[model samples]
Target chain A: MVNAVTTGADAKVSVRNLEIAYGDATALSGVDLDIRENEIFGVIGPANAGKTSFLKALNRMDMFNPEMKVGGDIHFSGRNTRGLRNVYALRRRIGVVFPLPVGLPMNVYDNVALAPRLGGQRNRAELDVIVERCLRRAALWDEVKDRLDTLGSLLSGGQQQRLTIARALSQQPEVLMLDEFSIAVDPVTTMRIEDVLKQLREEMTIILVTNLVQQARRLADRTAFFLDGRCVEIGVTEDLFTGEVRDQRTRDYVEGRFG
Target chain B: MSRSSVTDFDRRNRDWYIDRLVQAVVFIGGISAIVFIIGIFVFITREGFSFIATEFDVSGFFLSQNWRPTSESNPTYGILALVAGTASVTGLAMLVAIPFSLGAAIFIAEFATGRVREVLKILVELLAAIPSVVWGFIGLSIMNPLIIEWFNVPVGLNVLNAGIILGLMAAPIMTSIAEDALKAVPDRYREAAEAMGATRWQVIAKVVLPAAKNGLLGAVLLGVGRGFGETMAVLMATGHSVNIPTSIFDSVRALTATIAAELGETAVGSPHYQALFTIGIFLFAITFVINLTADLIVRGIRNK
Candidate 1:
């Protein structure tokens, strides 16, 4: 059920019939989603709806766990992701923000510099520039520039999340995936993150996964409602939020009658 | 005003009392253990410090190659030979233990499947269970002969044999500790490295190893301490020569082996007896310094 005009419109990431299983249980069942370039896409669902699993598959993290098996077509920049056995290279093109901050135990500067340094840029000046730019983009430079040498674990929770985002940004990924980015953060910080996401969408594609429907409506250019490992509906954010609802389940869910 | 109300409140208060009891017991036990450890250290230093005056001709004792305490003409007991022998053997053992243990640790921490890792971990733990005396016996019977025959060595009991046995002994410890260190490295670090287009080997070499460098360094030093303090294996494997051995095949005596071997024959109040005690003090000092250095390195890595 692909929309005629919007189905393949400048998509940077395309997943089709994506099925993932861990032993006897299935995490995702024939899920398909298209992510457009330079757009903030939101995936809204209750817990266990495979939102994080979907984010992980985009970067081949499901393969890291030997027990989990993924069967599907994930196309990135017109190439089949499965064919690219180089997990590092694939991940470089797509970065992830875990639910928690998950900052490395290193200094903030090193945390930001790590990806670029490992990606083969050895010049100190170049790294310095990249770190500053990323931290600035993440809106963390003001608070952290003075304490770049301080261990990342010493930062406040919201600052740590921003620093993690900055660390991800230093890789210069084409698609940035945030899995419950604001779940551990306060509402004031959440608003700041939404602003950062808005600015970030101008530079790269972003996929925001959250259960907060209002948050999805606020930041996403397009939103997909997921339930039970399947997309119930996907469309332009405004249309999806305000337009006539068809499916009774979708209507009930959108109206906050049920999940 | 009802009996039910009083009963419910008492039940709530009961849980609080239980929690307080647990906390009190744990706090007292932990503090008492710590105080006991400190007291032991203080007592040892106070009792042993008299003989170990920092000004006691330590240069020759550490550097000289002589090993005779009794002579018809003149008696001398320079501990240099024993210290050097111990150093050489422990150094070689560490060299062997570091690579093998780190390799095994990395394999278990990163590459092995869950079931395989469990099996490997159990095997490592079993290795730790084998008695040091058994290792000494094995080295004496099986390994000493092999070295003598295979290498055509003049003495089967040599540094090489002792070092090999010590390395084997130290591996399980290094492997286990290093595995823990590697495991302590956050998965996010590995993820970031991978996201940067680094290969698995690269991720380990650059990110995982550096992050765990402090822990790995501590593990290695602990292994070295194990090799250094090893008494039975060295006594059985080494030929207990007083003279400094140039080659791995030449016989040598470590401080621990000397103490174990000579304590029975030497008179209690003799100079030889005091000298052995001196050697024990020296070994203790060496381990203390090594552990201290390890602690410093671990702190440095953590605070970096």
Candidate 2:
């Protein structure tokens, strides 16, 4: 779908002719995207449409899966990320949250403290501030502040999701990716987290992958509609929702037709 | 009978009977193991009761450093020296085994890829396959001379030599079990930690090892138990001096070694022979406690 679009020089993340596969089975092919800085770039796609694969590619999370293979040029903040020796540094800057509530098997405080600790922050006072700030930003401080000693895994699903977000936030990321962050979260918690994401975009670039098309309309500045391992449409969220989607499939998806 | 004539109800009833039969079979199979273990304990303790009643000095048997079973006139059977010997050998074995075993486990679980992991695993199994008697022979012939050359001790087959060989015997078991524990760690934890910029070592040290604590404990304790109960290797490797070891190089008599050396020569129904049963109880108790603790840890892991 991005075949007609030109690569934006000012984009924070630029993908060109990207193709991804696991072993011999292709997941995505001939994909291109330019994600501008400090915008909530929403990726909306059906299940198995390579939305998570795209996100995984950005931070080289594919390293964990030996079967996964990528053939593309992905430039993050103007630096090429292909075969980069320091993938951990790249991943640290591009924080990611999974589809499920995956709080670390540790206390609430340690969950948030982990990223900062990984970054070599040893001072108890500094860690406290970092943890508190991240938790507050994730809108989990009020619920978890009194029970920082409790295991994060023991929390309610919504709370754990928030704690995961808080942990991601503690990484001091330049780009924050939330992959179906509201999958198990309550509607109220979802709205709260959406609001938090809006605020977060002011400080860092946000990539929001969601099945909820309306969630994209609510929070995304720019949205890409992925279909069957291809980008079917890419435009402003408002333009995509304005009953004039460039692609018919995007209109169909946005209007609750066949995904 | 026609296939259609056999109703679904009849087939279901047949399945129910078969399932119950299988269930009963499995129940008996499981209970037999427990019954056998209990039977061994009961039979041994029955033989030991006479010794415990008359000849066994409960306190001095453990505290006193005398272990003279062969003395014709005044045969003292204080097992404190034997217990001390067992402790030193087992303790020294642990010190040698833990780092190497954990290193092997980490390498297999975290670092080695598919084929390499399998190859390393086979190597560990090969190590475990070597008999205790062969290890004892190797220590006696090859290692003892090297020790005498280096340490300049009169006899090279001292506590150090026995402990070294025992450590070698136990390392494979420890590594394999620990690796299994490490492998059992959920991938999500590593993914989360790595996403937070934690390196591979950091993920292992902070997350994988901590998450697999129970398994690691079980592995180490079971390994220690192996060292504790090993009879042939310690009997051949240690010089079997009946005294408290002042140093790692000092010759000592482990509980297993004492039993192996004296059991055949002692007359049946004699106090010395019955006292050997008491020593059996000591060995049984230590092995039982270690195994039980390991089982508890495994159960706790399963419960979690």
Candidate 3:
């Protein structure tokens, strides 16, 4: 049941009948979603609901694990992602931030510059500009500007979270997948990052996966509610909150009832 | 209801005795290792000192370049040449071993999975199980001639030859320890790198290797310790010449080789025998320091 108004628009990422399994256990099964271009697409679900797995699948992170088995099609910009020869190029265009912030063993400056360096932007001045722009976009420039040489791992949790955001942003991705990016961040920092995500929406598609229903409500143009590894409902964010959810479970979850 | 049968008093009594028994057993286990080490140290030192009493030429013992204990007119106790030989062979060995070992480590940690990784690990363990003398035999029969033919040297029994053998001897150990270090790096770091468009090689070179830096260093140091103390292999491969080697190709004698080669023939109470004991002290001290420092660095990294 596709919404007539939004179904055929320029979709940035399209997933069809996506099923993911790790050994004997299945993480996600029969998931379908289309993330439109330059829109903040929110994913709200409870723990173990395969929200992170979905984000991981979007970036083809399953390639790292031999045990992980993925079935069905995931397309990026009308091209089948599974068929892409250069996975790194596809990954560069689809950046992901995990639930927990992962700081590189190197310093802050190097952390942001690393992706660009991998992509062959070796000029120091150019890296410096990219790093500054990304950090500024993530609202982390002022605190870390003076300490760019400091070890990335030594930053405070909130700052580290922002740095992860900045690092992902530095890649200049087509679709930015943030999987519970604010879990480690404080409420104030979460709001700041939310502002960053809203600002980033004009340039690229945003896939914000969160446990907080209100966060999805606040930022998403269209929202998908995942339960037991299946999308229960997907509608305009306002409809999910304004007593117009297609599924009763969506209304219950959005109204702060059972997940 | 069952609480009445197994009361707190009875449980506490059983727990206390079992805990004491465990404590005593663990203490004995831990203390025995230290005691054994200390006892060995004392024994070696006593033997080394017994030699010193007759001839206390400490400077000649350490700094002298000539080692002619068998000379009829005069005997020199200079160990500089032996030390030089040991240094050259070990240095060359390390140069060969580190690259191959690190490569194996990266392969096992980042690339191989499932049955392949398991098989490789067992193969590494089997490589280590092969006796040092057997490795020496392999070097003597196979590698020595190859080296001579490859480099067109006068003799294959030189520092380079010994070094190659020692490098093989140390590679398995180096690979295992380095693999441990590389494996200790969390998956998240690798994922973060990959998600940022980093290739497999780039992720390893930049993130995983750096994260495993101290552990990798510890692995190298352990390899050095293994190379330094290796006796039978070096004894067989190195030509056992007491002269300092001018190059890796020149025939040379490691300290262990000298001790191993000369100790059995000399009269037990003689200065030569005691001097061999002195060389053992140097080997022990150097091994202890390298291993201890490596342990410290690894622990420091883990703590951080």
Best by TM-score: 2
Candidate 1 lDDT, tens digit per residue, A1-259?
2233334657888887888788878888878788999999999878888888888888888666776788978778666787675777888877778788877767899889988887888999999999999999899999989999998878999999999899889999999999998888888888988899999998899999988888988999988877787777777877767755555666566668776
Q: Rate the local accuracy (lDDT) of all candidates.
A: 0.82, 0.89, 0.89
Residues forming the 10-long window of minimal summed lDDT in candidate 3 chain B: B1-10
> What is candidate 3's lDDT per residue for A1-259, written digit by digit as tens?
2333433457778888899998989988998888899999999988888888888888888888878888988878877777678889999998788999998889999999999999999999999999999999999999999999999999999999999999999989988999998888899999999999999999999999999999998999999999987888888999989989778888888888886
Compared with the true structure, what per-residue lDDT tens digits does model 3 show for residues B1-304? 4666646654556779899999999999999999999999998889889777778587878889889888888987889999999999999999999999999999999999889999999999889788999988987888788988999987888898899899998999889999999988988899899998899999999899989999999999998999889999998899888778888788889998898889989888778778889889989999999999989988877887
Maximum-DockQ candidate: 3
Error in Å for residue B208 of model 3: 1.1
lDDT of 2 by residue, A1-259 (tens): 2422455678889999889999999898888889999999999989989999999888988887899999888888878888699888998898889988887778999889988887888999999999999999999999989999998889999999989999999988999999998999999999999989989998999999999999999999999999988998999999998877878889888989887
The recovered share of true contacts, given per candidate in order, is: 0.57, 0.57, 0.93
| Model 1 DockQ (Cα-based) | 0.46
TM-score for chain A, candidates 1 onward in order: 0.94, 0.96, 0.95
What class would a CAPRI assessor give candidate 2's docking? Answer: medium
User: lDDT for model 3, on a 0 to 1 scale?
Assistant: 0.89
